[model samples]
Target: MSRIQANLLLTLIALIWGSAFVAQSHGMQELGPMMFTGLRFLVGALVVLPLAWREWNYLAGRQLALNRDDGLKILGLGMLLTLGAAMQQIGIKYTTVTNAGFLTALYVPLVPVLGWLLLRQLPHWSVWPGALACLVGAFLLSGAQSLEIGLGDSWVIASALPWGLHVLLIGRVADRMAAPFLVACGQFFVCGLLALIWGLLFEPFSGAGIQAAATPILYTGILSVGVAFTAQVVAQRYAHAADAAIVLSSETLFAALFGYWLMGDRLAPAGLAGCALILGSLLVVQLLPLLQPAKTSSEVLPIK
Candidate 1:
């Protein structure tokens, strides 16, 4: 995919993710987090079921369809994603929303380092400066006058490592698998099943616990993870990681905007400053085209 296409994908990913938070917050009002996650992902997977036949056909020519190893690889990816997601969900529950937002943003910077370690690809030097900017932004966005790591902060911060790892894994495997099929299908199949078993073994009464969260549940399952994630996989196929990260990072901005518009949350002065810094850093990374300038906002915003 061209750079233009990549930027557009990231933008769409950010928009979807940002909007989903509204659904998640609303859903959690009535449902338990784990159960909510499970059902929502299952909804997304069901959406992708129609594409499974296409995947089966595609894979049959290049690889085995009903093989143990193939199943294991996808399952492994699912397990890792679930672990990261569970950690993140728990982190958000404990920490202030401010901390969760910026902390999770660390995954963008963390990706380059993880890439270096796993793929033997040296990252750009500019990444370090961008990472530092992101760190300060997190500190500021957390709205803390004094630096004190609460238990919640620790969990959220720690979870970002796994989230970063998940991104790297996706980046590596996006080319190998049927991107939409794997993303949408596996959300329900892999994470859904795992969450279900976890709920049964540990907290079986989840359905009864969160029966009233239908709106959010349906929104997340059908729209956010199901549609947005499939789009992300398709977009990633076209965009570079750095460009993609820049676009998706807009989730923070979207969340803040939506929070203010929909939920009456205010963006403090410092918070806006942090947001600007993060946005600037993200934009700074896109100067790689040199002779050919990347397109403007049209490339960054996808109406679809």
Candidate 2:
């Protein structure tokens, strides 16, 4: 797969996730955040099971070699994902909506920084400007006039670290794993297990509540978790982590768009400016590399 194709896939993942915000909100109406998260990911694991099985069968005759450490990495990814989700959900309870939105988008910048520290891979020069642009856009779009840090806001900020790590981890695992579908399944299952355990411990879960949130659960599980996440794993195999992160961050943009269209939400002048900045950042990230001279072999970082 080419970089463009990989980026397009990432964009699609962003779209799916962006639109699924509605379902997420609806699910919370009948279920605790933890309970909803657990059930949805469990459903996602089930949704991916057949696809993973088919992929396994297809590779049965091939000389496919599995890495000994892939399982460990996949498990780590699931744990990180669960932590990120849990933090965001819990943090939202105590923070302003604007704070939650802007802080969650902090992962846009965190991804490249984590990649540099952990993998020694520095992004292209254009990525910094794009990331900053996205950050400012998110801040403006969030409608926050001042910055404040409460416990909930702190949790949200903390979540960005794991989420950023998750992005780089996906790139590394995708580079090494033979079966993306199976990896995705393992991720979902592990995440589901953790979420379920936490939900059972702290949140009330009932069949009636699950039934009430069934449609939202199904949409998130099937499309957001099953399809979008699998696609992300596959797409990151071809794209650089930084590039993929920039594209995936566009989910915030899509969320704004969907809010305006579906919820009768209106964008103020600042919000409109934020949207433009985000769009400009996307163009910078996507097109600047093409305009610049190609990197020599020594300049390009090899995937581990």
| Model 2, span 1-304: residue lDDT tens | 9999988988888888777665766677787878777888888989889988987787776856455677788899889888887787666565544345445666755666677778888776777887888777756655667774367667767888888787667756755665767777888888888888888899877889889999998998999888776676678778866677467767766766666676555767886787677667765655565455654211111110
Model 1 per-residue lDDT tens digits across residues 48-127: 78787677777787765546655666777677767766666666556544445556666666767787988887876766
TM-score of candidate 1 versus the correct structure, residues matched by position: 0.80
The count of backbone overlaps in candidate 2 is 0
Candidate 1, lDDT over the whole model: 0.64
TM-scores of all models?
A: 0.80, 0.77
Instruction: Evaluate candidate 2 by giving its C-alpha RMSD to the native, one decimal.
Output: 5.0
CA displacement after TM-score superposition, residue 100 of candidate 1 (Å): 3.8
User: Which number leads on TM-score?
Assistant: 1
